[model samples]
Target: MQDTRATTTVAQSGHATEVHGWLKWLEVVLVTGLFLAAGFWLRPDDPLHVGNTFAWPVLAPLLIGLRYGFFPALMSSLLVLLVAGWHYDKAAATAYPWGWAAGMLACGLLAGEFRDYWERQLRRANAVNEYSLQRLEEFTRNFYLMKVSHDRLEQQLAGSSGSLREALRRLYGELSQTRSEGLNEESAALMLRVLARYGQLQTAAILAVEGNRNIQPKALATVGDYEAVSESDPLIRYAMQERTLVSVQTEFRKHLKKLDTDLLVVIPLISSTDDLVALCVVESIPFFSFQNRTLRLMAILAGHMADMLCQRDQTMAGSHEWQSLCSQARRAARDAEAFGLPSVLLKLQVNEQDLATLADRMTGLLRGLDVIAVNRANESPSVVLLMPLTDELGLAGYLHRLELDIRENAGRSLWDFASQQSLVVKTEAQVAEWLAREGGAID
Candidate 1:
């Protein structure tokens, strides 16, 4: 139906153009006939003798050329030629006026060419203007969408609702109290409870993955009426294959019709080392809560859970310094990306003895939000300070104060003891690269 309507509209437009063109040609004929009539009436014996004075008949073709371009002008010039031929035949002249005919044709053709050139330029300018208008409309729509999204996010983050950082802090504190060697059954259940509250999930379960490939039939933790998910379920398979979050609204759009399982979303708990630890499957979620913002929030929570489990696993394996640094760096990176917050990593080369002496002093000099860690396992001992919510100016102020305090307390400057390097954390990959270059491993 739409195609037929579009065809009809185009046919109507073509008919209109044809009618308009015919009218223009008719005007050319009328104007040229009037010029010939007036010439004959003024001087019947020599109607074409105006060539010696002012060739007024040429004005008909020139005007038509200037108005309607080449074709109408050509028509008018042909009519004038016919009149000249008749006049010459009546006068019984032996030779026709070839020079006068050429002059009339030349005026029409030149004027028509000039008209055609400007018309082509006008069409091009119109096309460019139309394209620019379309682009402006698209940009305006996108800007409005972004503005609405920003306002919604601001409402979620404002007042007593508490920030995402606070919620994650509570999650970590709860999880830490339960286990020392990765997430146990109790801690996993606690994590699920927290997720259910924030995600507005009615039914969800955390299923353990054996060897990061096969999922266990029994769920380690569950919220609401949980059921076991089949290994062949498309959503499960896609989430396992992608090692990222999958939902009916996102990556599962293609297989949505063929989806065999009753799943709303699947959240993967992946360790910092890229190991698939487990899967958090949502059997049911609130209609309103199942949106892009909610999915992103769930992903962030899933990351923090993975970090906790991985931290415990690494601690059991006796890599505390690396795990601690990885957790802090990941948190800083996530905060920076989400909230446009800044964090600076200050690395100072120092011996183990100096670390023991200055760690307490540095902690006193820094703000409460700042984090300090000592790495004594490497051949050359060093200290890493993660200053959260700090930019370049804040780092300078802290450094100056630290130097002044160190000089007053020990009668020596900070540079005399240790050389330091600092970086503003933006992404986890950036921090990892900085660590590798500074003789430290992020993983």
Candidate 2:
């Protein structure tokens, strides 16, 4: 009883909602004290003893309420009442104990219910927080992808707009002069100077290969500064033999180590007869290397220049020029571009056989782009030029221009309607394959 009384008193003193070990012991001690006090104070001979008879037991419920809470109150009340009833033999004493126990039991049930309710509420709040955080992370990821896609689209549109304006300017100029030289050497030189002035580190040179004594006329040959690289230079030899252009760092390791070495580009050209190879070299130095698109542009410009030289020679030589000029021009106008830009894979095609002659012509004609290689298709005799801005309208405009150019220059059409359809189908297939390889967007 003393232990129970001690436990109850300790429980009564603690924070109401928490059950503590010390309180339980204290209540035990407290209960024992009450029982002992009542037993000692009672007088069996007195009538007042009957009323005081159930006092200890009745007090037990109240004590339990104030200390051990509802459940404990109920148990203690029942115990006390039973002791009182047995001692006094009064029905009223026994009834009061049961009533006290019942009241204490109800209190305990209410307290436990409230505690459970609070626990459930806490769990719900935690779950909601976790779900919200996950959603926020997903939203952020999607937002970045959308932002990047939007920016890329915008850049492409701007570039397209600029190209259109430039083309329009050329059309207007052509209506007036009607002569043939769209951009002369002077103009081309000015473009390079401007690019250089704008911090782009512009470089220009030319190469012509007619039977292979590579010749550079303006910049490559006479910048007044010459590197005595003969046909024997390993980089040059490797480039010619492999018939593929290699990066300067990968090709000319010794030059790459030189602090003064600027960026260098090598472009190759093959003639119509598949007999000549021409190489063009460009040298520049800047904080950043040239972008892949720029490198490709260099290769393209070289190819165009080669075709022009071939045209000039044939035209100057007159009518029976083996129909040579027209053949070269036909091949030149058909090629287009479709490679990924800003990295690598820039290309050009040439159709010539006389190395020295081809090299000399390529050197004079190529201005900015390099000549990477000159090779024949092992499987097909055709040249492929990936069309830029190539939706239906773009294709229509390109076809119209190409047909006119080839017929007027060479008296022959590159491809008729059916042929062009086949070419487009092939190009589309190639584009699909390339997209898959690059992990880029599909058309």
Best by TM-score: 1
User: Ten-residue segment with the worst summed lDDT in candidate 1?
Assistant: 1-10
- Best candidate (score: lDDT): 1
For model 1, what is the error of residue 330's alpha carbon versus the real structure, in angstroms, after optimal superposition? 5.9
lDDT of 2: 0.42
Q: What are the runs in model 1 whose C-alpha is more than 4 Å off?
A: 1-161, 252-257, 315-319, 327-343, 350-354, 364-371, 377-381, 387-418, 426-430, 437-439
Clashes of each: 0, 78
User: Per-residue CA lDDT of candidate 1, range 1-443, in tens?
Assistant: 01111111112322412235456556788998888888899878767654558788899999877766776678788889988998898889889989889999889878877776766776687699999999999999999999999999887666222546566667767777784466557877988988887788889998887688978878889989988779788888989988888897775566456767789899988766567778899999988788877777778778768877776555322246555765667667865775466889998887766776567778788654566777665577777788876899999998899888888887888888788889998987888787666555666
Question: lDDT value for candidate 1?
Answer: 0.76
lDDT of 2 at 237: 53
Q: What count of clashes does model 1 give?
A: 0
Give the Å error, residue 275, model 1: 0.8
Residue 365 of model 2 has an lDDT of 35
Measured with C-alpha atoms, the lDDT of residue 364 in candidate 1 is 86
